[model samples]
Target: MRSSPVSRCRMHCYFETGSPMCGGGTRTVFSKRRAGSGVLSPVREGSTLTHGAQKGSISNYEVYLGALVGTLLGAAPAVLADNPIIQTLYSTDPAPYVWNDTVWLFTGHDEPNSDWFTMKDWRLFSSTDMVNWRDWGKMMSVETFSWASADAWAGQVIERNGKFYYYVPVTRKGSSMGIGVGVSDSITGPYKDAIGAPLVANSAIDPTVWIDDDGQAYLYWGNPNLYYIKLNEDMISYSGGINTVDLSSFQGHFEEAPWLYKRDSTYYLAYAGHCCSEDLRYSTAPGPTGPWTYRGQVMPTQGSSFTNHPGIIDYKDGSYLFYHNGALPGGGGFTRSVAVEKFEYGSDGSIPTMDMTTEGAPQIAPLDPYARVEAETIAFSSGLSTEPSSDGGGIHVTSISNGDYIKVKGVGFGDSGAASVSLRVAAANGGAKVELRLGSRTGAVIASCSVDATGGADVWKTISCPLSGSATGQQDLFFNFVGGGDQNLFKFNWWQFARK
Candidate 1:
């Protein structure tokens, strides 16, 4: 007995019998004799033998079983390792912070199809491996602040004494943009207004928070004019009045979006320079607040977005620059998406010019195929969105149309290969097919599973399909969707594979 390819079995068994199994009727026993051996072998008695049969001896039941088994066995996995890490939502003002083993990213949600910066809230996402970002959803919003009337703009979060503090700019009722502080016990927060009033209300914005070596925390933010305040140990209050930074040496246009960080006693102020179409420029200071020396532009004026924001961090021994651009479909200045780049610091602690790219930072490590991966964790996606799942407090891939797909990169299946694939999905309309392809969209289809309606879009049901073929080692995986008409096909929550 030999296992047949999944495609051949699917074509011969499914199309011919209309049943998943060959030789239609329920059977008490099935057997397959080895080719040329002539010895009847019963792998299971009073049970359906769903896999492997002698050539030409495959019954309709066996063919259906073989196809199902192949669908499961050949079920491959995928990963997303491209720029604009979060595909489901448009993110801007990427603020990344390292906590324990994960890089937590906080960003502003750009309203879809907006002509202006009609942002209303902030978003949270995290990733251990840069390739896959876990969407934590809305962490804070304008409604979180009593004094805020509108505009949930660029901000930064820093943990102090187990409490997390977020500094952001929002529109005040009777004034222009003002900075406010939000506090929570955890990094991913349902934070409340730390203070009922604006922290620094002199029309400030784009607050970047950093604590110095001597335990002094500093908040830097402003548009055209840069300002810094020494935050007291309470983190909610400042020791003195806000001090302005002199920008005489910053030669290029100094606009806004200041990212303040220190590396080996060198304090760097990376900001969005120039107006209209801002570029990334930085200056060095001797201390947290300083008479700075300009260090040329870090990134020239480029990318589709007119304005840019910078968020820099060092993770897993690698330096990463997180920024935003109008790169996604229907993206623009008001609908920007966050992106990241890996770079090295000069010996003098200066940042080299970084560029936006579709090929984002390399994966810190290969994805484990045996572990469950969320469907929303995509490298590159088309025609998809995500929402909260009903079964549990988790996210699922949604807004799927025919021909929509997601690509996950560098998925390691190992040498023995996968035995089966299981996907937790739900369909309101049903009749959707998910085709697992390796390497590319038009690549070899390892397995295809038909989705049945699970009553509701959130009603998740696990579907297991047999899989075949050598799905060993590292390879890019693509999940190509197919369904009738233009309606959404199904929602995918998570997927995993069993080892051979």
Candidate 2:
């Protein structure tokens, strides 16, 4: 379980009508700083954004605000509303990893509204709360593997010995499919090919890695057939020879995409069963390489996609299954999106069948609006797309049009409420406004900031807007774009709130 960081709190008086009372107490707020830094400005006397508790000057409002902020200081609500967890792009072959208290999601990107499996590179996203995922564009690509020409397919990542290893399927130039590995010190990586050659050149796909309790690592991948190799501590290499799992003892039909994991003393292997329109099924074994027994379906064939892939993990005392489906607006077999569902194992250790849902996974924690949050960190959005930031650091929300909006769930503005908001944006065609709304896209407007041309779409600037009109308590925050033009309004990078 993750603990909440100590927050810099303030006091404010509110009327029964829910408007700020103002003038009764000394209002204190904090200056904008990078989110998650845990550093606050030194408290000064009579400052609007002061920090720490004010002794003897406490009032009922102060007590109420203090207690309210304290009670809600921990995890916030989820920002997600439905399936296809990410709406910015078509993300498929979901691979989620938990490290350093965060879930790092790696997926293959499908070309916009393509007809085939047109994948070029792999993408990355991270989240503390399951709903609002932050986009980290293009972790590694076919370009990352020099010898590989095309097909950046399904893969999995595992962390070992302070190094992160990514095992993925790629096609070596003129040759068959091979499993390639990349390594980096950071989970959000500038990963390089660990070995310039393919780790396993077996003409197979969908690689999943598992590190056992005894510290032995295993790599599993294939379609129509299942294969595994005992990986050395280095992870880039394997010991002994490649081994195959016999399918005769399997109960259900097996097509491809095998995910191996162990819970308690039982080993589980979940895979896509049957081709054309595949269903998610699994089997169990006592060890990593099993004389396996096929279990029933994990998920029956559903969604718009003709194929499905599964990635499962136990996070925050909950079991989550990550998979992809053709459920987006232009989604199909080629244009797929990732979605997750929270599930529990049966008392006998069998996975109960689950249905694909738009609600996705429930928010395990609430989002802190007082902290700096990336524009790409979204729960639900419409009429927008994301791209590599103009500043070249990370991704920013882009392709935004008038009337398009982004929704962030469970924003804890606290009882004191927000005083102002800061936005980092860039505009090629200027004259756009960001309307900060509460509850819904058409909800109560708390603030709006005008955006002017920044010379180019990539040229960046920061703007601030003063907030007002009952923006208190924990509520869903929406960034509604309003502008006039056929072109995009502006590119958004990040946003932060100053406490009232």
* Whole-model lDDT values for every prediction: 0.74, 0.75
The CA lDDT at 89 in model 1 is: 73
Question: What C-alpha lDDT does candidate 2 achieve relative to the native structure?
Answer: 0.75
Candidate 1: tens digits of C-alpha lDDT, residues 352-424 = 9876655678888878879998887776776677676775876777778787788777789998888889999
What TM value does model 1 have? 0.82
Q: What is candidate 2's CA lDDT for residue 283?
A: 94
lDDT (Cα, tens digit) per residue for candidate 2, span 329-375: 44455667798999999999999998776567888888998888999
TM-score of each: 0.82, 0.83
lDDT value, residue 126 of candidate 1: 85
Clashes of each: 28, 8
